[model samples]
Structure formats: structure tokens, C-alpha cells
Target: MCRMARPRKPLLSRDRIVEAASALVDSEGLDAVSTRRLAAELGVSGPSLYNHFRNKDEILDAVADAVSAQIDLSMFDESDPRDWRAALHDWAVSYRAALTEHPHIVPVLARGPGRRPAGLRVADAVFGAMVGAGWPPAQATYIGALMRYFITGSALGSFARGFVDDETAYDPADYPHLGQAHLLAERRRQVDEGAFETGLRALVDGLSVQYELLAPGGTVRPAPKRS
Candidate 1:
């Protein structure tokens, strides 16, 4: 009585699990992902998912990290001679692109790196680049936090989507300046992308001034005490 040979390829893997979960989140939002749903999607028993992930939160974390892994960090390359302003402009654009693609995962990713390696790498690259450019350590940390807030806030929702498409929605009496507000929904992509770029440029420009004001030795001057 010979036993049947095991299949050459396993039906489930960590990568496979993450891919399925990420797709679910992308298509149906984060709440759509569950261990049972994943098991069904993967053509495996519900309990089998436990072999790869301890719980749905773990799976979601993996999915979020996978999204983080897609972000471009080359702009922050140590070998690049680009100044902090240039590097930040490039990095913020790349960061926004990644989050825009996986908007459903933005909430998870916005929670900071936690223990996720890919997320940590992103934070490290940004902070290291800022510090290497002569920003004080505290300022470098603040820069990282500021960029995260800006990028993640931009990704969290669509400004265009907030407007109603009906031309009557923006009454001429109530919103004289928003005569074309109804058109925004039809041009969601353009409006959103343009807004992101405009904000990014303004943010970097403002930071550039602050960067130049850093005192010699890379520290900011303390505020004067009131007499």
C-alpha cells in the first residue's frame, strides 16, 4: 500500500496569502478582507490560512507592508548629490504615487512603521537623507513626520469626490466662486493629481526656506525668552 506522493507545489504560501489579501482590499476595501474570505479565495480550508498568518490583522499588516514595499526610495540614495529640496520633491511624488495606487491600505500604512521591515526602510531612507543633508536630528525627525502626514492625508480621500456632480448642487447664491465645482467629479484624476502636485511643491518650498535658516552646525536657534 504505497501512499500518494505530495504535490510538487504547495497550495498556499505567505506571498500568495498577502497577494490575495491585498487584492481583496484593493477591490473591496480593507474590511472586505478576512481569513475565511481569503481561504475561500485561495481554494483552501479556512483553518489552512492560519499556517501562513496568525490572524486577519496580521494578513492586513502584510498587505500594507507589501504596498509600502512598492514605494520608490531611489531619490533618497546616498550617492545622489541632489540637495534636500530636490530629493524631497522626488520622494514625495513617488510616495504619493504608491499610496494613491493602494489607497485602501493608507490607514494601515499611516500608522507608522511599527515592526514592518519595508515600512521601516521607507522611514529610514527619508530620515537618513534629511540628516545627511545637514538637518539637525530633531529637525530630520520632524521632516519625516511632516512628509508622512502630508502624503497620507493626500491619499486618504479624494477632494474631487467630495463634490456633487449635479450642476445644481453648488447653488449660485450659496457658492458664487464655485460655479464649476460640479465639473470636478468628472475630472477627478486631473483635479486630485494637480492638487497633490501643487501641495507638494508648496510644502517643499516652505521647508527649503526653513532648511536655509538652520544655524551653522545644523541646529535651529532657540526662541528668545520674554523679558
Candidate 2:
């Protein structure tokens, strides 16, 4: 007598598919991912992936949003507006850490702004904090974009080229400026290694200087008021 075959498990779902896809991205580089690859990992056929996601781009967008959800916003809670600099630095560092944790998904974020609820919330929180800190709307937006760009570039570089040597081990005699900063950063790694903090501070400082130069009391002194 022939034996009966075992039935397939009914565990397949969109959420599970996305989770598996995210795991695949975490373990393998983005170039190695595809719907077919995700399906195989999920124990389903390639076409089954489409049943859950419209296409690969949709899957990527979902994955990016999922990664974004991991970012913690509580780092921004501050009583003093002047403390905005420290709070903002902490937020940027945390954001960078979350992105770095899923380095493979960095490209997706760089490619397209994600659609997930958490992703949008993160953006809104950042912009809101900047505005609350007395930055104009446009300046807040620009600052947000600049911070994201810096995080994305660092995450990609750290993944593609490991973090130790380039950022820390430069020769002092040959590159005094880099070497000093590297040593200081190494010490501050206990606090924040200084990538996000340094970059954010410099950007804000530069913007403040520019604003002063352009504002009413600024140094753009009127054009001699002559004929």
C-alpha cells in the first residue's frame, strides 16, 4: 500500500515573508536578493512572493520601513531647547546605529524614502525637533536631509570597508589632522565616536554662520547706498 504524503504547512503570510526577506538582506548583500531568493528562503514558490508583495521594489520598500521602525525616538526627549544640540546629536547617532545594524538595507533607504508607518514617523519626529529648536522650516528640512545623507554614506562605507583602520589608524606623521581627530574619536566612542555628532555640529554651525551673514544684522552690509 502507498503511504499518504504529508501536507504543507500553512504558515505563509505577508509579514512572515517580509521578515524572511529582511533576514536574507541582513545576511547577504542587497545584490544577492530577489523575489525568487526570498521565496526559496520562505519555503514557497517564486510566484508566491508576488501574492504578498506587488514586486521586488515593494518588498524593498517594506524592508526599508521595517528597518526604520527599529530606530528609537525617545532619544530626543529634552527639557531645554539649548540642549537641542546634544539631543539632536544623540538622535543622529542612534539613527546611524540602527541603519548600520542593517547595512544591506542602506541602499534601499538611499534609493527611495520608505512607505512604512514607522519610517514616516521617524522623519516627522526629526523635522519636528528641528523646527522646535528654532530652525526655519526649510532649514529644518535641509538639516534632516544632510543628516540622512551622512548616515547613509557612513553605513555603506562601514559595511563595504570595515570600520577600524580607515577611521582610526591613520599615521600621525603623515596625516596629523586626521590622526588627532581619530584619537579623539576613539576616546569618544565610549560616548559616540563622533561621526554623527561631529558632522551634525559642523553642519549646524555652518548654517548658523550663513544665517547670520544673511539676516538683518548680518555682515552682508548694504551696497554702499550709492548711485
| lDDT for each residue of candidate 2 in 62-164, tens digit (9 for 90 to 100) | 8889888888787555554445566667777788888878989998887646467777888888888877766677877887888788778867753212334
Tell me the tens digit of each residue's lDDT in model 1 across 1-227: 99999977566899999998989999999989989899889888999889878899899899999988988888888788788899999988888899999999999999998999999999999999988889999989998999999999999999999998999988999999999999999999999999999998998998887877788887776645899
Which residue pairs come into collision in candidate 1?
none
Worst 10 residues of 1 by lDDT: 216-225
- Global lDDT of model 1: 0.90
lDDT of 1 at 103: 94
Error of 2 at 224 (Å): 16
TM-score of each: 0.92, 0.70
Clashing pairs in 2: none
